[model samples]
Structures are given as C-alpha cells and as structure tokens.
Target chain A: MSQPASNAKPIILTGDRPTGPLHLGHFVGSLRNRVSYQDDYNQFIMLADSQALTDNMDDTNKVHRNVVEVALDYMACGIDPAKSTILIQSQIPELAELTFYYLNLVTVARLERNPTVKQEIVLRGFERDIPAGFLTYPASQAADISAFKASIVPVGEDQIPMIEQTNEIVRKFNRLVGKEILVECKAVVPEVGRLPGIDGKAKMSKSLGNVINLGASADEIKAAVKMVYTDPLHLKVSDPGHLEGNVAFIYLDAFDTDKAGVQEMKDHYTRGGLGDSVVKKRLEAVLQDMLAPIRARREELAQDKGYIMQVLKEGTMRAREVAARTTDEVKAALGLSYF
Target chain B: MSQPASNAKPIILTGDRPTGPLHLGHFVGSLRNRVSYQDDYNQFIMLADSQALTDNMDDTNKVHRNVVEVALDYMACGIDPAKSTILIQSQIPELAELTFYYLNLVTVARLERNPTVKQEIVLRGFERDIPAGFLTYPASQAADISAFKASIVPVGEDQIPMIEQTNEIVRKFNRLVGKEILVECKAVVPEVGRLPGIDGKAKMSKSLGNVINLGASADEIKAAVKMVYTDPLHLKVSDPGHLEGNVAFIYLDAFDTDKAGVQEMKDHYTRGGLGDSVVKKRLEAVLQDMLAPIRARREELAQDKGYIMQVLKEGTMRAREVAARTTDEVKAALGLSYF
Candidate 1:
C-alpha cells in the first residue's frame, strides 16, 4: 500500500484466505480481478493466513506453508507484485491492533447479524461453539479495509454483507470521532463471480474439497472433468441432455473462448446425439489449455521459496508503515495516545 | 515484565483499568497487595486503557487522562516503579497480536458463559448491545497473563472466573501445540479482596461513584464518612447499633490500627451509648490519617506528569521486549513464522 501521492486511483483491498492453493474458482472470482486492478488502482493483495486460522486452527502448519503457495499462485495468475502489494496478514501487527479498537465500536449482536459471518459459522458447523475470532472477523476485515483507506473491495455476491459490515464500522468510527477519518469501501462484484465446483457445490471452498486447483495436473483435470456434475437422466448417447445445471457447460461458458463452437455443442447436446464423454473431452481440453501455463509457472516459482518470502517481506514492510499511520490516526481520534 | 534471570522469582500479572483515580477501596483491595508483592515477586502492573474502552468507548479521553492518574495512585500508594514494571496496555502491540491468536482458541459460547462478563453486561444495562470488545476481553486478559508467562495473578473473589478463563485458554493452546508453552496462573486472592462502597453497595467501583479516592481531600473524606451507610435503626444516641454491613464500622475495622480502641467503640455502640455522629467522627479521623500521606504524594506526582509518563515509557519499552519474545514463541508454536 503506497501513499496517495497525487494519484487519483482509489485503493482496492482484496485477497485470498490461503487455506489452500488457488483454484479455477479463485481465478475467475478474484485473482483475475486483482490482476486487472493492479495497474488502474492502488492494489493491496493480502495472503490472509491469520484469518484462515479462525477455523483451521487444528492445522496451523498448513496455513504457514500455504502462504507461499498462494503467493506463487498470485504470481502465476499474473498478479504483478510490483503493481499490487502482496502482504502476509500475520506480518502486519497493526491490523490486529486496529481491530482491537474497532471491536469496541461494533456490538456483539451486530456481528451475529452479519449474514456472511452467520453463513460461515453454519458452514463450519460451529453453531453454538463458534470461535470468537470467527464471529469478530468482520471487524478484522473492516480494519484491513480502513487500514489502507480502501474505497473499493472486490468480492462475490455472498460477501456483499462483509462490505456492508465494513462500512458500518467506518461510519460508527467516524461518528464516534466526529470526523470522517476512515473511508467506506464499496464491493466490485465481477460479472463472472462464484464459479461452481467440479462436484456442483454452490461454492468451491477448501473445506468442501470439491475444487480443482489452478496448478492441477492434466490427469487430475481429466478426472475432475469426468466427475463434473451433469444431467443424470441422459445416460445414453441418444438421450437428450438438459443444459441447465450442467457443470461441464458452466465451465465451458466461463473458460472457453470458442463461443460458437460451445453453442453448437450445447445445441447438439440438447437435441439427442452428443455423448457425455464427448462433452467431457471438450471441457477437459479447455481446462488443460487454460491451466497448463499457470501450472508451469507455479512450479517454476515454487523452486525458490526464498524469493517468494522476500517479495512478501518487502511488501509487508511497506504495508506496515501505511497501516501504522492509520492506526496512529485512529488512536489519536480516540485520544488514546499516551506519550 | 523484566527477563527472568537466575533470581527465580515467580512472575505476577496484575493491573487496573485506567477509568479513574484509585480509591480507598482499591487501596484495600489489590493496590496494597501489589505494593507488598513488589519486593519478592516479579510484577508487571498494567494500566489497561484498551480494556477500559470496551464499555467506556464514549469517554476515551477519560481513560487516557486516568492512565496518569492511576500511575500516580500507584506510586502514591507505595508501588515502586523501580521494583514493578508499570506499563500501559495500548503501548504493547504484541499483546493485541497475541490476543488475536488467542481469540481463535476460545469459543463465543464460552465467552458468553463467563459469570463476570454476564454480571457486567447486566450492571451496564448492555443486555443485547454488548460491545464485541467487552465480550472478548477475557481473551485479551488471557493474552496479558500468558504474554508474560506469569504464574501468579492477583485478583478478587469476583475475578476468580477470569483466572479460570485464562487457564482454560492456556490449556487449549498447550493442547493444540502439543506442549505447555503457556503457563496457567493461580489467582492470589488477598484477605481484604473486596471492600464495601460508602453506599454499602457490596462493591466499590468507578461506575458506581460510591468511592472515596485515595487522593480524596480531607473535606471530601469527611463528607464521604458522613454519608457512609450505617445502621438506620440506631438513629438515637441511646439505641443499640448492628455492626454487620455497617460501612463506617467496616472502614474502622480495616483501617484503624488501634484494635482495642476500635473494640471499645464497637462495644459502646452495641450497648446503646454511642451516636452515629460520634462513630462517624472516629471513622473520618481514621480515614483522614490513612489517606493524608498518599494524597500529598499523589499531589506531588501530579505536578510532574512528564515523570509519570517517563516511568510508563521506560516500563513499557521493557515490557514490549518481553511480550514480543512471547509473541514470537507463540507464532513459532503455531508454525506461522515466515521470516
């Protein structure tokens, strides 16, 4: 996160949780948007390993190792570290301190009312035993957004509630301080957000294990395409297939550039002659073509983890300074600066 | 917050919320014990301004100014800054980071079930609108205790649950790490752990405004003694008085050095030959004698606020080093260290 030195670009804050390696779903949903925003906006891409530990506390070593994996995936997916600051959340202690103060501005009931947090708790099956971190992550998210004074956050439809919660905290903080020191961020919902998983889950989350990683090998990609959810009624080559809810067609729609060819296949499949294996072959070919270079780049970047860490170190050092300034302003507003 | 040398002194973690000046109740409850322990125990006395803002978010400036007032009270009451590390909570960012990780180990249901927090929510009339910080403060307190690896925590009967919560978090972290990196602390409940307010409200607290501050002027102490809750049935000079729950008698019992003389006065009051005015005169005298030197010392210290801040700065700088080491260990335990 750089200073706003006469640059009119609004800061964009977005990142992955680093629970695992990046996936096709991540590519279409956020990584691609991050790449697009890197040049036009002052981008701060975060590897949110600490936030990932809220539910993954059982496997912290995994979180530790995935920082590099996510960083590698970001680089492989065209997120230029020079243009977008790629920071590790755990390295920036100011965010935690910022969250400590922001926590007082929001009520426990408000956090419970956050639709995104509620959905997350339910998804994690933490019903009555929700970790305090999970419930208060929205405040932490708000701290991340306000620490950089980010005015734009790229998120999917399900995460719109998170943006609302961040703005609420911003408004409450400003109202308490009697000044607008924190900027409210708006969600940049991409047109191709929320890519369904290969197994047809609503979202491709790590916990569900239904995802195909961006670094998936050709064999793994082939297996995933064969297992892609499609119409069960059309078992024979002569039987007509329904296009609705077909994961293969959805993948083609999202990734394939040959629109007319895909349309021809959809028509043939809808009529009564296209075999399921034929459609699977086309989907697998498209996915292989898309992920082969990314896989190669990821392997190449993975060779030297030291360079990945150095990039994170430099980014975090710069981000630490920006976040420290924001925290100082917040403390001054609260009259908490003792010295 | 000093390093544990070959001296082999068990560490004590204790502190006060810098909401206001220390009162007579504070002197009797914990401040006296803190002074006594400074010689033999490795003590870290914290001014918990961050925790104070949990419910007092609107009056942050009060919490800020009172950090010095509390430090003054600490010094005035014989807590030597040379022996005790008197640090400010907000100055140690490591504690906040430690608390961020500790929050993942505690559950929302567990925090909700804390008896002290429940009582505080009811006392503050924050039934449904409890601040998230207020609810999560036990986690923060655990952070404070574990950050020092403190084995002794000076608390009252009301705070036994807090000690229990701290130990629970410690055990959870140890269990997750498969080793006991965090030591559980035992609560040292002083003999005079709690003192009744002047209004006989069972407890003297800043929010209740029923306290006679240690820095109270002679006239203020006298007025407070005059308003002290006494036996209402013994209004006449010839009526017998009940000493139980009588705050005037309680103060005399706690502060008066001449035990035989106090017993003589109690006998006369029980035998229907003493007036409330007469007993109040003696209680006022006892309070005045006890508070005179403390008030003078507090006044002397108040003249140089810079010295008080300097004490905090030096103490906090030392404390920051200790806590940073602890946080580094915790992060290492969680395998979150990147560089």
Candidate 2:
C-alpha cells in the first residue's frame, strides 16, 4: 500500500472524466494498458470528477452518479483496486492547492496556445467564451501529474501536447525556484492509438451514441453491430466489398483474438463471399465473449455501491498522503512552509 | 466576537498583501477604515501572503517574513484580532478550492478583458510574460470575497472592475447552477482614495521607495519629509505657490486633525512667504504625533512574534469555519458534494 521500494518501478498516472461509463474506446486506448501495467508499476487510477465539471459544470448530478459507474467499469475491466489505487479527484484538496501554485508558473498565452485546448475550444464551439477552467485545465492536468510525481502518463496520440505542457511547467517551476520539486512526465502512447466509433467517426464517445459501453449486454451489442457503418457498394453477396473505412472490419481488427481468422474474414469479404450480416455476426460473437464476463463483474460491483465508494474513499486517503508530501515539498521549495 | 444583531451592519472584507511593512498610503487608503468599521460591522481582515506570491513567487522568504510584519502593523493600526479576524491566506485551503470552482464560472477572454488586470499588466510591463497566477488573481480575489460571504469589499477605485468581475461570476454561477448560493459584493471605495508617493507620484509603493513606513522611527520620518515634493516655483520664499500637485499639502489634508491650522498653512503657502522647509517641519510634527502610539504598539508587538503567529493561527481557524461552510454550499449547489 505504501510506495514501492527505493529502486521501485516507475509510476504511472491515468484516469478518465467521470462524465459517463467508460467504453470500448477506453479499453483499447488506456484501460487495457492500465490492467497490464498494474503489476509492473505503481499505478494510480483517478476518477476525474472535478475535471469533468470543468466542462460539464451544469451537470453535476451526472458527474456525481458516474463516479461509481466509471469505477465499476474499471473494476470489470480488470483494474484491481488492491493493486492500483482508485481515487476521486475532488476528495484530494492537495491537488487543488498544488494547481493554484502551478498556475504561477504558466501563462495565459501558453495555455491558450495548447493544441488540445485549442482543438477542444473549436470542437465545443466556445471560440471566445471559453471557461477559465477549460482554458487552464492543462495546468490543472499538470498538477494531477506532478503532484503524484508521476513519471509515466498513459495517453493517446492527441494528448502528446498535454504531456509536453506538463513538462514545460515542471521545467519552468524548477528553474525559477531553483529546486527540482516537481518531476517531468512523459506520455506512454497506446499502441492501438484510437478506436473509431461504431458510426465510423474518428473517436468513440458516449455523447455521440456511437460507443459500445464496456459492460454492454448481448442484445445491446447486437443492436450496435447492426448499425455499424459498412460498404454500401456491396449490394449482393457476390459483389466485391471495400474493407477500407468499414467500421465492422475495423472493430474486428481491434477485438478479434484470432488474427488469422480475422484475416480470412477480411479476405472473404473483399472477394465478395462474406455478407455484412455474416461479418457482423462474427464480430458479435467476439464482442459478446469479451463483454460477458465484464458485464457480470459490473453487475456484481453495481450491487454494492457502498463498497465502491469505500474503495474510492480509502484510495483517496492514500492518494492524499502522497500528494501531501509533494505539496509540502512544493511549499518548502517556494519557501511557503510557514510552520 | 460573534456576528452582529438582527439589524446588523453589513459585513466588510478588506486586507493587504504581506509583501512588506505597510506605509502611510495604506493608512490613508484602507487601514484606518478597517479600524473604525470593526466596531460597526463584521470585518474580516486578511494577510494575503498567497496573493503576494502570485507575482513574487520566487521571493517567498520575503513573503513569509513579511506576514508577521504586516500582521504586527495591523495590530498596531488598531485591527483587533479578537473583534476582526486576521487570517493568513495560505492557511485557508478552502479559499483555493473555491477559487478552482469559480474559475470554471469565468472565461479566459473575460479574465483577460478585466480592466484591473489589464492595467496591472501594462503597469508591471508584463504584456507577453504575464504569469497565469497574476492574470487570474481577480478570480482568487473573488474567492476571497465570496468565501467569507462579505457584502462589502473595501478596495481602491481602480478595483471596481474586480468587484464587477466577482459579481459577474457570482451571477453566472447562480444562474447556471439554478441556485443563489453566492453573494454579490459591493466595492466600498474610501473618499481619501490613493495617497501620493513622497516623490509626488500617484502611489506610495514600497518598490518605488517613496513611502514612509507606518512604523517609521522619528529619524526616518524627518528624512522622508525632507524629501517630500513641494512647490518648485516658490523661489526665495517670496513667490506665490501653486496649491495643486503639492505632495506636502496632500499629506496634511489626509493626516492633520486641525483642519483650521491646515487651511491656514495652505493659504499662507499659496499667498507667499511660507518656506518649503517650514511647511515640511510642520507636517513632520503632525506625522510624528500620529505615528508615536503606532510605533510604540508595533514595537511591543514586534517583540512577541510567537504571539502574533498564534493570533493568526487562531483567526485562520475561525476564518476556515466560515469558508468551509461556503465551499460545502458551493459544492452542494454544483452537485460536487459527494460525501
């Protein structure tokens, strides 16, 4: 439960906005990696409810209700709470305090120039009316990373800029204060990179209704697979199909365990032998096999909401202990430790 | 002391940054009002060491050392910790947490457009390199004001925009969250307004070296008065002098209790035959008489640094109770109070 040995494995920090239950995109992008990394590193999985409120401030009820949903998803996905700490962001006051201090090291111009922030502004259509929290969240994210002294941040390709921004603040603060109080973090990009939405969009998001939740039921999976974007030119079984931009085949590539079997299916579809329903049925079988266990685990975890909260509360206490040590170091470096 | 009665006077929130010992300008600007307001209203006096570090982040030892210096000045200037809470800014973690929440209510563009922040950026010559903390301090100020639920915030006229900005966030939060959880604050500008520096500049700033410390010794008082700006056109003490832009007369108008004597001096100086040295010596006498009791009190308080710190610790505990309650309400309104 304490920190690893003196020559411990490097630490990893990763989490999701508690806006909704995590989905297959999360599994392919970071969750599955977190499951694999639990034993190799000291992992801290955070339920970023505070960060979720930065944009969804009006929907606190959703954010509040989703903290447990997200935790359940993590547990069902094999993120063992005993091996990896599961924390609620708002419960740690030290992170907010550390964020306040980090803001001094960054500039509005720099925050505005952040690629992720800029893209989100355009995506959200908040051109001139961006929230201060939304705009400065890079600094807040930097706080989340550095407060834990997290050296490895598991993120997607698009989030490379955020990791760079975190390191910039770390360097700026250390240089200005003449103390290496904060550690720089590097992003560990997932090999799967991104999983397109069921509708063939670039990202699988809950808001778009294109996502298949990690704990989706068999019927729900079949319904989502039926709507999956496919080759419109393939009118009959004998017509040649285009595999490129086919959402069903793309998902099969990500989830199908048998690479040779997936290759044979792709070959048969391109050569006009496999029908869309036939390919979808194959994907349904693979997904149902993967999701059944998760659904069962999620159902069992859902029955004990108090236990889920207790896990988060206990993890928050442990997380706060580490964050407090870092905050004390930060204050000592800034000469703000009055006592 | 507890809050006032049913028809109680409005609460007032005012404070000074602990960057240095307060000077004559602080006395003329706000400290004097705080002393009298303690008897009529619920007043909360803060030693804003955290805000001081927004710009002076690298010089925290200076900030740390000055907290006690500023607190001692407050006590000597008649700000009773028993009647008016004298809390340190960094001690109340709730304020920082509240600031984080309030940041979401404000926008980056709106913060940049704040007139006070804009003017300060120009004045500080920080057009390109402005610190994020410096730009967002208005929000932090808003947190300071709202955390205490102060109905009245005593500030300079230039800070009117800051009050407007705070109220904007308050209204936005209440409207968006569909709850009236925050109180809007009114700026209580003093009639005396800004005090001119000894060199006749518009501000008596410690960095400008134009200030006479409130706890100045008699010798320091004479030295500062000797350098006070006066009418340059009155050669040989025989020429008529312009009353406008005379720093000495301005100080007398603010400090001299004998209005008739000050007017006679002004009339004599305007009509001619009154030497600058004579006027300076007379003003010196007035300032000395006023500062004697303050200097004695400051001397006594300076000897008991532990007592001053204990007072701050106790007052911080009291301030945290009020701030914590407000934070809880804010969270409940935002649906962030998970526990």
Best by lDDT: 1
What is chain B's TM-score across the candidates, in the order shown?
A: 0.96, 0.97
Write candidate 1's Cα lDDT for B85-136 as tens digits: 9999998999999999999999999999999999989988999999999999
Q: Residue B33 of candidate 1: its Cα lDDT?
A: 87
The TM-score of candidate 2 is 0.96
Per-residue C-alpha lDDT of model 2 across residues B150-217, encoded as one tens digit per residue: 98998999999999999998888889878778888899899889999999998999999999999999
Regions more than 4 Å wrong, model 2 = A1-5, B1-9
Q: What's the TM-score of each model vs. the native?
A: 0.95, 0.96
> How many pairs in model 2 have backbone atoms within 3 A of each other, for residues 3 or more apart or on separate chains, i.e. clashes?
0
For this target, which candidate reaches the highest DockQ against the unseen true structure? Answer: 1
lDDT (10s digit) by residue, model 1, range A1-339: 234567578889998888788898899888888888888998998889889999889999889988888899999999888999999899999999999998898999999999999988887789899999999999999999999899899898889999999999999998898887898889989999788888887888776888999999999998889899988899899999998888899999999999999999999999989998999999999999999999999899899988888999999888888899999999888887877
Task: Please give the lDDT score for candidate 1.
Answer: 0.91
Off by over 4 Å in 1: A1-6, A231-240, B1-6, B236-238
RMSD of 1: 2.5
